[model samples]
Target: MSKYWSEAIQSLTPYVPGEQPKGSNIIKLNTNENPFPPSPMVLEAIHQFDTDRLRLYPDPDASALKLSLAEHFNVKANQVFVGNGSDEVLAHTFMAFFRQPQPLLMPDISYSFYDVYCNLYGIEAKHIPLQDNFCIVLDDYAQANGGIIFANPNAPTGRALTLEKIEALLQRNTETVVVVDEAYVDFGAQTAINLVDKYPNLLVIQTLSKSRSLAGMRVGFAIGSAELIEGLERVKNSFNSYPLDMLAQATAIAAIKDNDYFVETTQQIITMREWTNQQLQSLGFKIIPSKTNFVFASHRYIEAAELMGFLRTNQILVRHFSRPGINNHLRITIGTEAEMQAMIDCLKRHPDIISL
Candidate 1:
C-alpha cells in the first residue's frame, strides 16, 4: 500500500496456489500434482543438456518444441503457441483475445485463475453459474460476451463436460474466441484438441504439469487456428520474447514425444482416483464423479474445515476452499497407494469426525 505502486498493482488480488509442505513425513495431496516421476526421456534430456548454452538465449519461437507438439496433436506448426506454463499462456490469452467491450463469460465454479486474469487486464467478467450437479450448462453461455473460457474437467470439482456440448457452444457462438483449459484432460476426460481443426474460433490450452508429471519444469502450450496463434504470439513477444529457457524447451519436447509412458502414468492415476473415491464413499462421503487426478467430496455430517484440520494434524493435507456453495467440500489429490492408505487409516482413528 505505497504511493509508489501503480494503479493495477494496488487493486490486484493475485491467485493463491496450494500449499507445498516441507517434510517427507507429510502426505501431500493438497496440490493436484502427479505422484509418479516424469518420463525417463525427460530425465535423460535434462542430464544431457549442455550448461555452456546458458550464455546464449533460447530460441524465441521455441521452434523444435512447437514442431514436436504439432506432430503429436496432429496440428500444423503454425497453429501451436508455447509459453512458460499454462498460466503464462493464459495470461497472454486474456490480453490477446479476451480484452473486449463485452465482458468475458465463464463458469462460476471454474478455475479461480480466470477471474484473476480478468482483473489484471481490466476486462469485465460475467460469471455463469454451474448446474445443481456442478456441471457446466452451455445454454447459459449462449447470450454472449467478449470470449468464453472454462476448464474441461473443472477445477476443485473434477467433473467434465462432454465434447458434444463444447462443440455445440462453438457452433452457436462463432463470433468470439473460446478457450478451453485442459490442464487435467489426460486423466479420464476427452480433449477438445480433436475439434480445434473444425472450429476456427477454438483455442485449447494444456500443461505438461499434471498428467506428464513435469510440474517443476513449467511448460504449457496452446493449439488453435494460425490467426489465433499469431495473436497470442503478438502478446507474448510484446511482453517477453524468451519465456521458455533452453532446458524447459528440451524437457517439454521429450515429455511430449514419450506417449507410452504418458499413457501408463495417467491410467495409474485414474485407477487410484476411482479406488480413493470408493473408500471415501464407504465412509459416508458424497463423492463427485471425477475425471481428473483429484476427488471432490463432502461428508454427510462433518464440516469440511474441521475434517481438513483433522487430516492436517495427522500429517495428511488436502485442499478446502472457503467460498460459498463449495465450502463444505474437500479436494483431495490422488496420491500413491500407500499415502492414500495412510490417509484412510487417519480417518479410521478419528471415527468421531466421520460420524459427527
Candidate 2:
C-alpha cells in the first residue's frame, strides 16, 4: 500500500499467524505449541551459553546444528540445512525450487503460508483440492508442475498421509522436487525422512516448535540430497548468511540429542489428542481422524465461529479458519490433561451447550 514498496510487495497477500493473547489466564490451545516445556538438556544448554560469543558472528552455514540434525536423522552434515525457523526455510525453498516456468502444485487446504510465499516470489501455484474427506490424493497432481509441497499430518485438518503414499508419489514424480513439511510429524505420523536416501528428489523439512517445545527458539531444518542442500545454501547466502545464531545452534544441538525427552513429550501429546477426540465426539462433534497434536472438529449443531466465541468468553482459545469448505470446523490444539478436562467440563456445565 506504500508508494515506496516494490511491485512484489504491493501485490502480496500476507499470511496471518494465530493470535497470541496478552494475558496469562487463558488456556491457549490455539497455536498448536507444545503444552510442556522444552527438554531439560536444552534449557541447561541455554543457561550455560557464554555471553561473549555474541561478539562473534554465528556460523553462516549453521554447521553445528546441521551436524546435530544429521546425526539425529541419520543423514550426512552436507545433506542438511538450518534456518531461523521453518517459515524461513520454507520461504527459501519456494525461492530455490518452486519458482519456475510451470506452476507449483499443492493442496488447496494445506498451509496458508504456501500461498503467501508463492505470491511473494511471483511463483504460479496450482491448488489441487483435497477430497471430500479432507485427505490428499497425490494422483490429482498428475499435471505438469514445477514442484510439489504439502504438509504431512496436514495443518488445520490434522490428517496425515502414510509414508507409503508419499513414496508412491515420489516414484512417479521423479523429475521435480517434493517438499514434505513435517512440522507436526512427531505427534503421531511416520516421517518421510527415511525415504530421502531412496528418493533424491524428496526433501523433508521439520521444526523444533511443535514437539520439542522450541517455538520460542524458532529453529527449523531440512534433510535431502547434498545437491539439493547446496541449492538451498546458495539461495540462503544470497539472502541472509547468519540465519541461526550461536545460542540457537547450541540449544538446537541439545534438543536434538535428548532423544528420550523428545519421545516422551510427543507421546504425551499423542495420548492427549486421542482423549480430546473422544471427548469432542461425545459432545456431538464430528472429529476428523488426526495424526498431529491437534484435532479438527465440527459441532453437529453449533456453528464454529459462535463456538469459538463461547470458548473465548470462558478463557479458552482455539483456532477457527473462516475460509470456505472448512469454515464450520475448529482446529483445537491438544493441551495438558487438566486443560483438556477443564475445557470439556466447561462445556458440560454451561447451560447453553448442555441444553443443545
Candidate 3:
C-alpha cells in the first residue's frame, strides 16, 4: 500500500512455493521433491568446481549445458532453451507467446503459478473446468483463445492427458502455442517432446527438480521449434544474460547425463507411489488415479483438515490445499519405502473419527 511502489509490483500476487522446512528429522512429503539423493557424479561435479573460474562470466547462452540436454532429448541445440527453473522458463513463455488478444486457457485447478503468471504479465486467463472426475476434457477446450498450457499428468489431481489428446489440441490450435509443463512426466506420462518435430507451435517444458533430483540446483528447460526457442531467448537476454551460473551449469549437465541414476530413482518413486495408493485405499481414503510422483486422496470418513493435523503432529508432512473444491484432499508425495511405512503406522494408530 506504499505510494512509492510501482503499480505492477503493488498489484502483483506472487506464487507461494511449497515449504522447505529446516530440519534433519522431518518426514517431508509436503512438497513433491524426490526423496532419493542425486547421483554421485552430480556431487563430484559441484565439489570439483574451480574457485578461480568464478571471476569469469558464465556463457550467456549456456551452450555446454544446452548441448547435453540436446543430446539427451535428441533435439538440436537451437531447439532447446534453458533457464533458472521451469518457473522462469514458464514466465518467459507467458511473456513471449501466450499474451494475445484472446485470453490464455488452462485447467481451473492447475499449477497455481499459472494464475500468478497471468496476473504478472497482465494476460487475461480463462480457466476451463475439469471433468467430474478431475480429468482434463479436451473437447471443452476447442473454442479456445490465444494459447493453451497444462501439465501432462495434471497437478494436484495427478491425472494425465494422453499424448494423443495433446496432439489433437495442437492440431486444432495450430496458430496458437500449446505449452505442456512436464515437470512430472518422467514418473509415468509419455512426453509430448516426441511431437515437437512435427508441430512447430508445440512447446514442452521440463525440470530437473523432480525426476533428476536436482531441485536444489534450479535448472529447467523447454524444447520446441527453433523459432519458439528464439522468442524465449529474446525475453531472457532482455532480462539477465547469465541466468545460470557456472556451478549450476556443470551440475545440470552431470545430472542429465547420468542416465542410470535417473532411471533407477524415477522407477523407485513410481513403485513407491503404487504401494502408497494401495495402502491409503485400504485405510478408506479414495485415492485419485495418479500417474505423477504424488497422490491426491481424501478419506471417506475423516475430515481432510483433521487428517492433515494428525499427520503433522506425527511429524509426517503432506500437502493440503486450502483452495475451494480441493480443500478436503491431501497431496502426498511418494517418499522412500521406510518413510511410507512410518506414515502408514501413524495412520493405523489414529481413530476413524467419521465412523465414531
Candidate 4:
C-alpha cells in the first residue's frame, strides 16, 4: 500500500468484473451480455455522429438522453438521472443516500458490487443472508437501516422478487431509501419503475449494458423522485460533469428509441435461457429457478470448478464464483441458440457430468 494514496483508497476493495478474453473464437457466456449485435441503427447513429461536436463538451446534464429515457419510461425528465454506467450510478447512490447512522442493508449473496460500494463510501452494511433456496427474503430486511438495496432477479443466482414483494418492502421501509438495481430486469423480472411515483423514497437503477447491447458504451440511469435524483446529481457534478461523451449520448438516444430491436433481442435471449435451463437440468444439474438471462446450477457429480475447466478446455467460458457457500455453483450466461447447443455437446462428452 502506498502512503501517498488517500486513506479511503488504501483501504478500499474494488469490484472484480467478469473476465473478457481477447480471443475471438472462444464462446463467451460469462458476462451477462446479449449475444446478438446491437441494432444497425445504433451503429449508423455512431457513424453519422458529427466529428466537430467533439471540440465542445457534451451537455453536462445530458438533456437529450435524459429526455428520451423519460419518454420511454413514462417519467418526467427531471426524475431521470444518467451516468457513465449503472455501476457509476450505483456508486453515486451509495455515497449519496446509503450513508446514515444505521447501517445499509442488502442480501449477503447478492451483487458483490453492493459490498464494494459500501466499502468505497465508508457506509455501514448489514448483510441479510439469502433464504435456504438462494432467494432474497424481504422479511429479513425489516431491521433498522440507513437504506436498502439489492438486485431484482439477483446476480449469480438469478432468482427474481415479484413486484408485489418489492412494493411490500417499500410500504414497510418508508423512512429509508430503497434502491432496486435492475441491471438484468429486462430479461425477466418486473421493473420497479412503475412504483417510483408512488414511493418518493424508491430509486430504481438500470443499465444499457445487458439489454441494449451497449456495454461497450457504458451508459446507465436511475429513475426516482426528482429530489432523489438531485442527490445523485450533486455527487456526479462533484466528481465529473461530463460523464457521457458526445458519441455516447448520440448512441444511447438511438438505442433507446430503437424499441423494436431491443424487444426482439431480449426476447431471443429469454428463449435461449429457457433452453439452456432445460439442457442443464437434463444433465443432472440442480438448477435455481432463474428469471434473469443466466442460470445458477450445480451438477450432482461434477464440481463447479472442474466443470468450468472442462468448459474452458472446449473454448466455452461460464462464470464460477470461488467464494463461501457457492463455491460449487456455476453462473452460465445465456448465449445464442447455437452456442448453447455447442455447450450441451461439450457437456455430453464429459462423463463426470451425469445426465438426469
| Over 4 Å off, model 4 | 354-356
Task: Give the residue spans of candidate 2 off by over 4 A.
Answer: 350-352
Model 3, 1-356: lDDT tens per residue?
Answer: 78898788888999888788897788999889999998989999988989899999999999999999999999999999999999999999999998899999999998999999999999999999998789998778898589998988899899998989998888888889999999999999899998999999999999999999999989999999999999999999999999999988999999998999999999999999999999999888999899888999999888888888999999999999999989999999999999999988888877884343
Per-model CA lDDT versus the true structure: 0.93, 0.91, 0.92, 0.92
**TM-score per candidate:** 0.98, 0.98, 0.98, 0.98
lDDT tens digits, residue span 119-177, model 1: 99999999999998998998899885899999999998999999999999999999999
Candidate 2 per-residue C-alpha lDDT over 142-180 given as tens digits, one digit per residue, 9 for 90 to 100: 789999999998988999998889998998999999999
What count of clashes does model 4 give?
A: 0
lDDT score for residue 229 of model 3: 100
Give lDDT for model 1: 0.93
Q: Please estimate how well model 2 matches the true structure, expressed as its whole-model Cα lDDT.
A: 0.91
Runs in model 3 deviating more than 4 A are 353-356
lDDT of 4 by residue, 72-168 (tens): 9999999999999999999999999988999999988989989998898889899899988998999889989999999998988999999999999
Error of 2 at 187 (Å): 0.9
lDDT score, residue 52, model 3? 94
Query: For model 1, where is the 10-residue window of minimal lDDT?
Result: 347-356
